[model samples]
Structures are given as C-alpha cells and as structure tokens.
Target: MITISGLTKVYESRGRQVTALDGVDLHVREGEVFGVIGQSGAGKSSLIRCVNLLERPTSGTVVVDGVDLTALAGKGRRAGKDLRRARSSIGMVFQHFNLLSSRTVQDNIELPLEILGVSGAERSRRALELLDLVGLADKAKAYPGQLSGGQKQRVGIARALAGEPKVLLSDEATSALDPETTRSILQLLRDLNRQLGLTVLLITHEMDVVKTICDSAALMEKGRVVETGTVGELLATPGSRLATELFPVGGAATGPDRTVIDVTFHGETATQPVISQLSRTYNIDISILGAAMDTVGGRQIGRMRIELPGRYEENVVPVGFLREQGLQIEIVEPQDEARGAAEGEQAEARDARQDESQIDKQDAAPAATAPALVKDGAR
Candidate 1:
C-alpha cells in the first residue's frame, strides 16, 4: 500500500512563494489501478513526481509499504541504499514514448535490465519474453521510429516492466495518441495490471481515462483534490461537477410544468428497472430524457435523465423512496418559480448566518481590551 499524508510543495518564483500541493492526503491500494485527474496545472504532475522522489516534497510523509521515504538518506537529498532499492521497485512511463530511435525494440525493452547489469544473454531472453507478453514479438527488430504511436507505447510499457517493478507510474501515457490507439494502450495497461498485480498510478486530464481504466480516482482542481471516489460512486453522487463533466449528455429546455431528474444505478440496481418500479408504485408518468450504459473496471453502471411531471414537492415521496432504493437520484432544476424559491431560501440562510456572526462579534466586543483587528486577523 502507498500512504501519503499532508503532502505539500512550495516554490519561490519572482520573490513570492507559490504552493503547488496543499496538504494532499491519499492512499493507493496494492495491485489496483489508481488515477489522478484534473485540468492542466492541477498539480497532478507534482503529486506523481513526489511519489517517485523525482520531486521531493517540501513537507509531509510518503510511506510506501511501511517505509517513510522522506527520511531517505537521513534527511539529505542523497538517497541511501534504501531509496535506491525502493526506486528500483517503482517504474515510471511518460506521455511521450521515451524510446531511443536508434535502438531495436528488443534493445529498448532490455535497457532497464542492462542498467541493473544483467548478463547479456539473460537480458536478450527476458526482452523476448516481455515482447511476447505485450504481443509485440513480431516487432522485436523494429526501431521506435518505424513503429506506430501505440506500438511505441507498448515498448515504453515493456521497458518500464523490465526491472520487475511492483509499482507502475504512467504519466499521461495515452493523451498524445488517437482515440483507437488510446483504447488499445488502456487495454494493455489493464491487462498488465492484472497479470503482474502491479499497483499502477496514472495521471490524466481526461475524465474518460479514469472512466476507462482506473478502479478509483481523485479529481483535482487548482492543486487541490476536489473529490475522490470509486468511478461508480462518483457518477452516483448528486450535483457532482466531476460526474457531470465526465458524462455530459444533452438535456433540453422543457415546459414549466415538467420536472427533470438525473438517475443512476450500479451493479444489480442497474438491472432492476427502478424507474418502472417508481412509476408503477406512484402512478406517475416519467419521460426518459437521456441515458447511457457503460462499464468501469467491469462493473455495470447506467445513468439517465428523466422528465417528471408537476412540481418537486408534489413528487417528494416518490423521489425519496427512490433514494432509499439505492438509486442515484438528482432533481434537475424545476422551472423559474422553483429556482427562485431555492435561491430565496439560500439567501435567507446566508443572511441568517451573517446575522448570527454579527451578533456573536458584537457580544465579543466588550471582552476585547484587544489587539488591533488588522494585525491580529489571522488569530
């Protein structure tokens, strides 16, 4: 298992300190494909860099398999044998297929073993076996320049595996490829994850990457992890900006009397025809707005948006019951009237909180023979 706690990174640029990671806490289980996803500059690159000690964190602890890696080399940047040993067990791949254009595929794949000083004959034999494993035995003699993008990635994956690594770090290994090539590469990663029982950590900006390959993932925004959940759990979470971004199906404008809802079901619940149950149980009509069925990590998952008649409060019981049935239920905004009421309620709540805060501050005023507010603001 990999455990990270209070991970932080800060850099001085133009005489100002900028924090790239803000106390990130995460756990990646052994033998599982985990993903870190975000828009550009989300510090995904920084987090993964910290994992391999490619970029040592400014603060926090990285414990892998019960070893505190930050203490490597007794606090100096020079890693002792412990750090080198740990690093040899962790392999990394890149967005670009960082292959030597001049070398044959077999030679490229054998580079890591060679670096470890394996015997020449053993390196060649092991390289062939890896080629066969990746279904690239036919391309053993081909140079990277002669292969397609997907084939080159296969080589990259093969080379990263040569050290018999327990962990595989894939950093945007598919974003540069076309869709079909990306799909093939993802399948290969999944197969390798299963075959080697390799704990894989991949970072990507595309949501589809997480939906396709990762069993569990975290969504990052501006260097902060906004949310982390199983892909299915994320899809089922209501008003999830990440899920909505992942599955952006079309929903049209409807009449004021019509209500819209987004529903999701997983595993057995997906096949239960719960909408029909809701209809039969409540005698209310439902119009299927849009839906899609897809599997993630081989788990059946489905999502749909439906239009329900009348106001939200009128169908509250039926909706609440659906929630109890373990279906993911999201009420799409009602018409302007309902929207206005919701906004009004939220504004009133905000006003109430502000009023309470003001009252509390007033109550505290007499007790303050106090420090100046400006200078003591942080307190």
Candidate 2:
C-alpha cells in the first residue's frame, strides 16, 4: 500500500519555477492495480518518479507500507541509506526498457540482487527463477538486442522483481509496444498482481490500459488529480467524466421538444432488458442516439444516450421510474441556456485534451495504434 499527501514537485528551468505536481493526495490499497491517466505534461510521470524518490518532492509526505519515505529522505537530492533500503522494496519498470546492453538477460536480472549484496549462487538461482516467472526462461542468455520489444519488457519486469518487491511501479510500460503486445503485457501484469499479491501503480495516457488491468484509477490534469475512484463506482456515477470518456456516447437533442439523457447500466441492470422494459411500460417511443457496452472489473457495464418525446419536466415521471430500477441517469439536454453552455464548454475541454493526447502519441516513435476498448476487462 502507498499513501501520498500534499505532494508537490517544482522544477527550475531558465530562472522560472514550473510546478509539476500540485499538492497531490492519493492512496493505493494493498494488492490493487491502480492507474493514473492524463495527457502529456499532466504530472503523471512526475508523480510516479516521486513515489520511488527518483524525484524528491519539494514538500509532502510519501508513506509506503507504513514507512515515511519523505522523512527517510533527508533534505537533499541524494538518498540516505535508510531511503535506499526503503526503495529496494519498491520496483520500477520504465517506458523505455532501461537495460544494460552489454549484459545478458540473466546478468541484467542479477544486477539488482548484486547491488543488494546477494551471494553469487543465490543471485544465479533467483535470476533463473525470475526469468521463468516472466516466461523468459529460455532467453536468459540472450542479449537485449536479440529479443523483441515485448520480450525486452519481460526482461525489464523480471529485473524489477529480482528484489522481490511488494509494490510495482510502471511508467508507461506498454506505450512502445504494438496493440497485441500491449495486451499481452497488461495481462502479464494482472497475472503477477494476483499471483504475487503485488500492489501495482501504473501511469499511462492510454485509456485501454486502465480499462484492461486497473482495479481503481485516478485522472490527473494540469498537475492535479481531477477524479479518483473504483472503475465500477466511476461507471455508476452520474455525469462522471471518467465514465463518459471510457464509454463515449455522442449525440445531442435532435429537436427542441425532445429531451436527451444518458443512462448507465451496471451489475444486474447491465444484463436486463431495462431499455425495452421502460419503452413498453411507458408506451412511448424512444430514440437511441448512441450506446456502448463493456466489462470492467469482471462486471458488465453500459451507457446509452436516448431521446424522449417531451421536455425534461414532462419526462420526470418516466425518468424517476428508470431510477427506481437502479439506473444512473443524467439529462444531457435540459433546455436551459446556462446549463447547455456549461455542458458545451465541458465537451470542448474534453475534445482539446483528446487532441493533445493524439498529438503526443504522434510525436513518439511510430508503433501500431490500438482502439481504446477493454478486451478482457472493463473500465
């Protein structure tokens, strides 16, 4: 488990102070895969680096497994012996597979154990065990250049686990891989989390990563966390930004007299014919503008945008009826100028963030792009 409070990191570039983290407060429960998502320059990388004291926070406390790392880190850039010992319990996987090119895969994994003063025989045994654990037992003698991107990452993961860390910190571990490779890597992480009871905290710009493996997630923007919750809780929340982004249903009121609303389905309701039931009970025709269904945390979840044949006031009874059946509903078109303008502004902001994310991806080295969908899990 990890807990960060009032965490702020500031950088001085060219006589100007730029804040990377702005009083961030986050908590990751034991044995849970937590994700932090945001566009470029959103402080996601900074926050993760701070977790391992790779980047010392300007001010705040970081507690891991009840040990206050900030306190152990005396007032300096260099880590003290206590802090170094604490860091050995936290494993980090980088976006770029940071491995020693000169060393073989087995040697790379043993490097950490060597640093920890592990004996030569024990290190060899442990390295082979880890290589097997990551499904790379046969490639232990291969060099980094000899392996594929996914294989290299597996080696990186095996190296990180050499110390048998209780927590795993992933910094865009799958960003550079192809879609199929990314999915494989995510599945590996999930398997490790369950098999080893590891607490994973990963930061990525890709929503598909969160949808696939994250048990809980936090949305960061402009150096602050805007939203944080369990995937199911976010899905069930009315007007949830995370929920809307995960299952984007687009459409607006087609006519002035119609009321457009979004309905969320989860748990029992996701499998039920709730929409048809509502239509038949009310004896009114409904128009579905958009819809999306996915699974999150082993549960089916869905969202739909529907148009009713009346104003918001006239549909109050029918909306209440839906709510009574345990559905989360939000009136997208309320026929109020101020509310509509606010919604429009929110939509614009979302589009701008998405565009920025796409630009960031494009600027990186070319790789196969994947659609943002939860293949084996839900968001």
Using lDDT as the measure, the top candidate is 2
CA displacement after TM-score superposition, residue 177 of candidate 2 (Å): 0.8
Q: Which lDDT tens digits does candidate 1 get at residues 96-119?
A: 988999899999998888877999
Give the Å shift of residue 210 in candidate 1. 0.9
TM-score of each: 0.83, 0.88
The per-model lDDT (C-alpha) reads 0.85, 0.91
Per-residue lDDT value at 43 in model 1: 94
TM-score of candidate 2 versus the correct structure, residues matched by position: 0.88
Off-target runs (Cα >4 Å) in candidate 2 are 334-379
- List, residue by residue over 1-379, the lDDT tens digit for candidate 2: 8999999999999999999999999999999999999999999999999999999999998999999999998877788899999999999999999999999999999999998899999999999999999999999899999999999999999999999999999999999999999989999999999999999999999988888889899999999999999998898787778888888886677778888889999899999988898899999999998899988767788899899998888999999999999999988845443455578799899999999997786567344433332232244
